[model samples]
Target: MAGDRGAVRRARDWTRDWGRIWGGAWHRGDGTILAALLAAWVLGVSVWPLARLFLEALAPGADGVPLGLMAEVLEARSTGRAFRNTLAASAGSVVIATVLGTVLAFATGLLRLRGRVAMTFLILSPLLIPSQTMALAWIELSGSNSPVLRPLGLAPPPGTTNPIYSGGGIALLMGIEHMPLVFIALRAALATLPADLVEAARIAGAGRLRILTRIILPLALPSALAGAILAFAAAVGNFGVPALLGIPGRFPMLTTLIYQRLNGFGPSVAGQVAVLALILVALALGALGLRALVLSRLSVPLGRGAALRPLDPGRARLPLEAAIWAVLAVIAILPMLALVATALSPALGVALSASTATTANFHEVLANPTIRRAFANSLLLSALAALVCTLVALPFAWLKVSARAPLIRLLDWLVDGPWVVPGTVVALAMILAFLPPLPLVGSLYGTFAILLLAYLARFLPLVLRPVVAGAEALEPAQDEAARIVGAGPLRRILFVLAPALLPAAMAGALILMMTAVNELTLSALLWSSGNETLGVMVFALQYEGNSTAAAATSVLSLLMVLALALALDAMRRWLPPGTLPWRD
Candidate 1:
């Protein structure tokens, strides 16, 4: 009887301990609020639409789970062709981009080259130009009646097809467009290289070539591979390059195929197209997984030290400098000059000269009410998305770093899903989720609200990533002291954390605004008559054969981007080092 009483007493103590732990966890007001907001955002933005898409794809009859439709879609001949094209183009582009970007990174980051800043900016110009604009510029530059080339007697024969409208052309442009991704990654890795090791190698009488090949290249390999994977994933999901180049070329990738299917058959074909989207998701995720596996094996620890200084190029400097400048001319300056000439010409086929140049195209585009509305809508949407995303990211990042809960970690991964998946998939999911009437907002099918929501979902990671890094670097002691002094959660965040994280948050906001302002892929699928963005306007003008107007619009958008970049450059002193991509 005494033994039984002792057992009951021990059970009561155990139950009380469990209750105390749960009570403490549930009573944390800040954590509870964060959890609730994250849950709502994830469900509304990422989880619901994706879940709905998969459900529809799996069960086209909407009765029960079924795999027959998915299997049938996969077996279709067109689907097989698109799958092959996507893999081939993405792989080819990654190879080209990785090689070019790695070379550029080494030249600018390691060599003592004159005009390195200018060269770096020119190398990264493709990232600022919208993909559609890049395609249009390349087309204009290479067309048979090309004004810029015609003046030099280098134009292709009249009536000859534009060479860029082929599979090889698509791969080349995609490679150029994504080169900046690899450049940034490799440059960062190069910047972190240990100066001590390089100096030690030099002391051992190693030549520049020997040191680079033996020490630096091996250390930078993992970053190069990661960048290649990123380029591949980006190429797979790219819509504008393929749409402008592929359709004319009779080449179709998964993204373009999805667009064609949806445009031709409407949402009635959502299930089939969703299956295509799933394929893209799988490709992107597979690349990312491969990167993870490779990085885990290739990563090595390095001692903390100053980064290596630039090596003297000796007699090779002048020739190397000329080569770099020539590359910049071909990739950036020539295309831009072609775009300008096209914009000034009286008609698409008109050759640009001092006598033939005019500003009528610009005047017409600027005077159009539709164009004006698009500019205003893009500005408003991008600004709101950037501002709201930055605000939410601050708290989300704080919670993510400070909280050790599995739920917070899961939420982080969930938020990244929309970003990793193609914009086409996100747009399709948005359509599936919002096309039907809601309880309060009715239908968001043709509304700007849908675009805004999609932007929020798609670009959240752009802001959140930097903010999380900033938050992780913050000292926890400040928060502890604030709590000790009776400061509430809101007060601590407002007075203590916000000031510290502002620079990173602002930098992220700037990047988000720049990217979202003229976004193409998402806006292409979601835009309606009144909801047109700058990207849609340029694309529509080009597709409608108003090449002059499209060129003018693209030039204006490029100017806007340049202005924003200059503004950020001017503020670099206040921001953390490496915040602005254009800066050293």
Candidate 2:
């Protein structure tokens, strides 16, 4: 009887301890609640789905933990060809992008060139345009019945097929699409170049070419390598370019191959296709790892000094400026003009003469119920995602800066997993995780919630990064003062901290909204009937041979992007440096 009483006493003590722990978790000063939310989001949106995909690939048909499926996938002829094609196209595009981007960066960042700001905007316009739209514009510009070419009597022969429907064409367009990444990286590096070093070299009688080759190139090499790796990763994961250009030309990359298999054979082949997704992930990760290694070994530390002054081109400035304009014309203006022409054409394949030009395509798309629904849906999703992500980012950023919890730091790292992983992989994981009825939610597979959840997961990092920057720059004295005045943690955050971080949060939300509105890859797999996004509708119209409608939709989408960019540009005076890409 005494021993039983002792056991009961121990049980009571354990219950009291548990209650204390639970109470601490609910306390406001500690970041326990915020940490828990972040953990839940990371697991539900990223970790769970990725783990399921890996498991499905490795253990198909209940055969537990075997390499047989992976080996078979690797050995398949189709897999081999697609892998090679992906590597080749990625490498080719990286080379092209690096060259073009480096030249543009030097001219705009280092040279005393005319209209540099406008040129920078034009050069980066591809980042605003969707990959599929870029591919479509190129197609319209190149085909035998090309509106731009046909008007000048320079159209290719009738029997000649569009050259853009080939692997080389995919590489070309992908390079153009990703050039901005390299340009931005190199331009940033150039902005940090020390004027003292360049001036000393010039004083030593070094010529322009000598200083450029010996001094500038070496210092910029690390950024160039980093940019090359980014371009390569983007190329490997790109679906729109491969889908629009490669499939028709019989050149399939891993992304497109996965789409084709799952789409054609349904979920029955999911495990098999997941093997392909794994390969893509491996390739992208490998490139990123290489980038890290190279940067670690090759990075040059610069002394603090004034920035390098722009160099004059003397008598050559006019020709160089003309060359820059011509390149921009080919990459930006021509394709846009072709898209406009196509949108104005009476029908597909019609010549864009004065008589054939009309606003019928734009009017028709605007009036269509389906198109209107898609626009509304896209706008709503993008806006909600931006607002929600911004809200969540605030507390998380606070936790990251103020909390010393190991779990908070770990969660911070894990949040980037969804952003870095290919969208195809993310979509596949989402399908695998949510295809069945969720506990209280029922099936989310066909609902708009799935898309919203994916967007939140994919874009949370965008909002988090900027807010963290703002939080890190903040002085902790104010919060401490508020606390000493008897203000609670919640009151301090709401009244003291929120106002300071509002601008950065707003900027991040604007960027997220623009990015998500025309997003393709995530929506490509997640979208269903009556739940179409602008990207899906554009792809569908093009696939159905309604090029005119597709062009009109693309034009409208581009206009929105430009309008947002302009709005941001107008507000750049009040924003911090580096907040707006075009402004920087």
Candidate 3:
């Protein structure tokens, strides 16, 4: 019996080895699968819908007018002005966020800044606040009757001034929303730099400014550029800021322009919107491609057993550090305070007008039926979607990182396709993909299931990236040892792998949930009555001219996101300080 068992095991090993050599070489096959999945996802999400919208726009009418008449309406003076306004706002936002993010990261990471922890938290805190709240506060400060301005003699006194509601206001909102990306990217990049190299240059008497401009800047430039590109893309795609701050002023970017073409102009204008959307797609792809290219070229590989260094805070650096700390703190605090103030205001739109403001908005928001429905829907749908995504994502991630199969490699490309695809495109494709003979499970054409699938496509990367990283950090010996003790595959996974992957898995899920809750573009198109998420409700209120309700819904969305971000931040600290699978 023992001999027979040994023979069977050997035979299985031989089969696997042959399979690895000929049909399914580990990572190669994995890469193939990844590519295929990526292709399927892109076709089903971005490419297909874009084609549909474009075709609809190009379709001719009985009167011989092209269906894309919406373009003509948008090309009018008002639409033209809005387009320029969006470009100006997006450009300004990208510049501001990139500059501030780089400076803050360098100050905190390289300079051994005082109050670093507090400063870091402050820079990141605005992420917890909704952009709508910021708009409200800024509006208050700019209001002719604002109490906040009275103290500083900054008020317009009786009835003459308001926050500049042009391109600048939109830019400011985008900057506040995007600043965190810059900080995170720069911080991570700086943390990985070889300190010994810097120390050697310092010992050789390199000046601080010279060292930064010559060495630090060049080394960090790729990461900074990558982050800046991402920030730029985000600024370009943003609808909330443009809708809230710009739309009222009649300003429009490509995103808002696209929305107007579809919602305002009707189906006849679909072709023109499709053409414009293609432009947006091209720009987004270009940005993503540039970042990928730069990162690939600049990245250096570490050999086995590379030595690592710890950051040291020296006595002589205290004052410089204090200055850095102060800047980061101010940047972080002001915006958050503004949001909190707005959310707690008794009157939603009457910013800066009175000191009599109370928590009426919060109470009203909490009691509202739409708010309640959105909250429940957001929570349940996001949670369910996250779970489904995590499960689906795990197998894909495993194929990419572990199996090393050619097919899996093909699928890896599919995973990345969603990153470049537009949200609108994804929603449209899902609608098409689920309509007829191949309708998704449960007639999901108009149900929560479609939203879940859309989200999975949009956000599976969030869950997969971290989990794959965790899985890779784990050693094969752990599993082998468990198997030697008679543990089956399922038992070994349950006992050893689950705990190891939990942190990363949870991190991914939280990120996905936050994204799903806050997402607007796709949700706007895909969500139905049965699945009315927070974003859709907010959009509805905005359309109804009930800006207060919109603001309230936006506040709810941001608060929920803030809670998740804070929880994850806490988990990062509470977990042992290491990037490995399990630290002390």
Candidate 4:
């Protein structure tokens, strides 16, 4: 029902955008109208699907009660179990993330250490790797078939269930994945910590421990709490970690439950899944509200001043750096080594060596036409997503930061709606919204178009955020100078405005492409038979017991991501501040 309304509304938006932009944007000397139209398009991407999902969830259906369906869903044993599992896993992971992230933040952010930049990037590796790929790496690291661990006799015995399928393993990996959020937030908060305050504490007979307890932790607690809550929210929404681990391990989560129900029963279960999605939304919202309340109460906003100088560890410096590196290697480096070893092995449980290793897995991954097609599809879709997002974000971000267009600015907040929600929820919304036939176009379900649209909606904010910051940083005089010379909207944007924001736009687009290329959760649900993404293929191969091939494919995708990240780092000297997350 709501799908039809959404389709008509989209048609209207298309008409408006085409009629206003190409027909008149060049004729007029102003860009505001063009910006608004683009912003409207961005806004529509979020609204239609979400609206459809809500309507599907709220409709009386066969029953006449409004809230009865929700109650029924909430009361189901599986639903209750999923909620409890989600909270327990999230709670456990948040504790892990807080401890690791806060420790890393202080060690890297406050201490003077050799090779800090490299160590910091290594520490943040979990964020760069996709959740599914990370799950695979950990599985390979811990499973009975692990080449790396089997050599050391540390692996669980064969015929024993792999321990990684347990709830504890899910929490451990998720914690590592989200640790960077807390690290970044706490570091940012610590950046504002006044050196004078620390210096005074030091001068007043305060030791390092006393100063840390009295001064640093107090000021940094609010941001750490905020980051922890963000981590908790993220854990609740995570699908890949639990899907890969939880399903085989028999640990049910809301994300896995939704996927299983929808995948098994199709869109007929969307209403029921929508109820689960609402639970996820509620958990995320509750986290946000808790953060705001905590910040309001506990936050001690301090004046900006000279940052505290890096503390010297003196006699402990070498040991401190070595310990940090060791921990990072165990968490970030060893699992990947295990994954690569598995990829190179001839078969499962085979140890890797120059004499024993074979390239058969790589050959299968690369030479298989279907697998090749999946790779091509992923690359093409990601490139398109990046290109389209970059084009749309330029105009929308300009108006968004300009402060002159209140309406556009108001609608801009909707961008985060699609981004922050669970990937499963967004994919479900896409299914519900486009499964039905439209006025001119037919049903988008099982088509390539839906995947592309989902990528756009999911990633536009990633591109727009940096561009908005770049736009905000621009001097109005530069734009005004061009306008004074009678330059048209297109001319000013192409010639004067775009050049200034190119670095930011490119960085965002690159990151967006990297993210979309190896995405598993959305593609897992949205992919059709011929349109398998790399993520779906790897997941399928692993599920089908082709572990070697899955590892090979995952390695290829991870290499692409790493290569792009390195390229971005190489180019970051020319980009704006905050473009690279790991940069000092």
Best by TM-score: 2
Candidate 2 residue lDDT tens string, 283-362: 88898899889888998989799998889999989999999999999999999999999999998777888887999999
lDDT of 3 at 283: 63
- Of the candidates numbered 1 and 4, which has the greater TM-score value? 4
Instruction: Score candidate 2 by TM-score against the native.
Output: 0.94
Worst 10 residues of 3 by lDDT: 575-584
Local accuracy by lDDT, each model = 0.87, 0.86, 0.65, 0.87
- Quality of model 4 by C-alpha lDDT: 0.87
Question: Model 4, 1-584: lDDT tens per residue?
Answer: 89999999999999999987766765555555676677668656777897788777776746778777787898899999999999999999999999999999999888899999898888778888989899999999999988878889999999999888889999998999999999989988877788999999878989999999989998999999999999998999998899899999999999999999988999888889999998998898899789889889999878778988889989989999998998899889999999999999999866778998988899988998889999999999999999998988777766566435666677677788888888888899999988999779999999999999899898888898988889988998887788778777767778877999999999998999888899987898899999999989988898999989999999999999999899899999978877776886
Candidate 1: lDDT of 511? 80
How does candidate 4 fare on TM-score?
0.94
Poorly placed runs, candidate 1 (over 4 Å): 1-29, 60-65, 403-406
lDDT of 3 at 35: 44
Off by over 4 Å in 2: 1-28, 60-65
lDDT of 1 by residue, 328-425 (tens): 88888998989988999999787777899999999999999999999999999989999999878877876677644467778888898889989999
Which parts of model 4 have CA positions greater than 4 angstroms off? Answer: 1-32
Reference-based TM-score of each model: 0.93, 0.94, 0.78, 0.94
